[model samples]
Target: MRVLVTGGAGFIGSAVVRHLVNDKRFDVLSIDKLTYAGTLTSMVSVNDNPLYRFENADVCDKTAITQAMSDFRPDRIMHLAAESHVDRSITGAKDFVETNVLGTFNMLECARAYWQSLDSRAKETFRFLHISTDEVYGSLGKEGLFTESTPYDPSSPYSATKAASDHLAKAWERTYGLPVVISNCSNNYGPFHFPEKLIPLMIINAMEGKSLPVYGSGSNIRDWLFVEDHAKALDLIAERGRVGETYNVGGRNEQRNIDVVNRICTLMDEFRPEHGPHSRLIKCVEDRPGHDARYAIDATKLEQELCWKAVENFDTGIEKTVKWYLENEWWWSPLRQRYKGERLGLLPSGA
Candidate 1:
């Protein structure tokens, strides 16, 4: 099947592209804006593959997205493009609103028009898979997992915009009869992850013997999912998931913020014994504004309905992730020059 993947050069998007091109050997057209986070080098593995093609276009561009949809004539449209960093979103939300909200609105409208133009068989087979996040469900207390039906109570501009996009996707399906399936996933980490996020940030800082900043008391919890596993789940949802339904994909592995950092440190120490005891670099810092206390996804619906299972738990995934950074400096070295481990999301002193 032919698939058009928006944001196909970013971390999770690249993973999906690699999986579809290498594993499924699907004809894939990757459309990305090449934002600071969306680097084409991430998809170097399959960039030259016969089945893979890429276009440097922002999803927010109605003409570009509409043209790509018309040109690719894909069986499935996987929408993964957005401004995804929480810390970055806190500092500048306009970009998030523009890309996540407006971009998604455009994607939905374009896809609806394209679907309408297709013949009966093509329309029936086409799927618009909207990738989303668990953060839209807001902060969870110490108890309970976020189900597919959880009411949205977004804590940050990032989540708020993503929630708006999710609503737009569902409304398109309901109002316009667009065949859309939504997947809200937990935190994704693995190879090709940008250095700004938690896992890679800690790993790189510890490697440089820099302080590993832990926000607040580092008690906030998050459910972690391997990026490759998420890529597979996305493919499954696109292929067989029911239209207008929501699926929550997670690794079912929960860890506190401090614990996750310490784990990365431990793995780093094992891999680079010369830089032993990396945990000593840990330092507490003020938390970001409206930091969510916890987030955990209940993926029972996805598992039972789609027969999906995560291959990597936290321990296995972290080990592979640390080793990837150590061995594949070729991919991340340039990114480090562009984005060092400086703190973000800091409000002005008076604010």
Candidate 2:
């Protein structure tokens, strides 16, 4: 089967593309905007594979995307293109709204036009999977997990735009009979991850003996999913999930921000104890505005309905992630040159 993936050069998107090409042995086309977060090296595994093709294009440009989709004529369209970094979205919300909100609108419109042109059987088989974040449900209290039925109460510009995009995908399904399946997942950490996010940032920073910055009291909690496990879940949802249904995918591994950092520091100490304890590098900083206290997902729907489960717990996953970074400096060094783990999303005093 042929599949088209948006943001295929990105962290999670690259995992999905590689899984499709190398694991499932499917012909794939990855359409990505090649943003600062998107590195071509992520796709090196599939670069020379005959089953894979890539188009350097943005989902915001509906005309170009529509043409690319038409040329690809895919059996499935996995919409993953979005400005996903919450800190970057705080001050840089324009890109988030434009890409996540407006861009989703364009993809829905294009998919509607494309789905209507196919024959009856092809229409029946076609699927458009909208991958999203559980952050759209906002912060959880000390208890409870985000379920598919959870109401969206976004706290950041990033989550707001993602919530908007989620609504748009559902609206298309309800209003136009478009076959749409949505998957909301927890934070993903694994190989080929860009260096900006918390896990990788901490890993690299500890390796360099740089102070590890933890926001506020460092008590914020998040359920972390290994990216490859998420890739497998996405594939299942795209192929077998019911249309107009929302599935929650999570690793069932919830960890506090500080604990996650300390774990990494311990790993670093083990790997290179000559540098002293990495915990000394932990430094609490001003927290990002609208920082959610916690985010966890209940993947019962996905687990029971689709017979899917995450393979890696946070401990196993984090170790693998640290090892991957240790071995793959060639992948992340250039990224570190571009972004030196600077603080982001800080509001000016009395703005």
Cα lDDT computed for each candidate against the true fold: 0.90, 0.90
- Model 1's lDDT to the true fold? 0.90
Candidate 2's C-alpha runs over 4 A off are: 341-351
Root mean square deviation (Cα) for candidate 1: 2.7
For candidate 1, the 10 contiguous residues with the lowest summed lDDT are 342-351
User: For model 2, how many clashes?
Assistant: 0
Clashes of each: 0, 0
Instruction: Residues 57-128, candidate 1: write the lDDT tens digits.
Output: 989888988899899899999999999988888878999999999999999999999999999999999999
Candidate 2 structure quality by residue, lDDT tens digits, 1-351:
999999999999999999999999999999999988898899898999999999999998978988988999999999998888888887779999999999999999999999999999999999999999998999899999999999999999999999999999999999999999999999999998878788888888888888788888789888889999999999999999999999999988888898998999999888889996999999988877888999889999999999999988888889999999998999999987775445451111100
What TM-score would candidate 2 get against the native?
A: 0.97
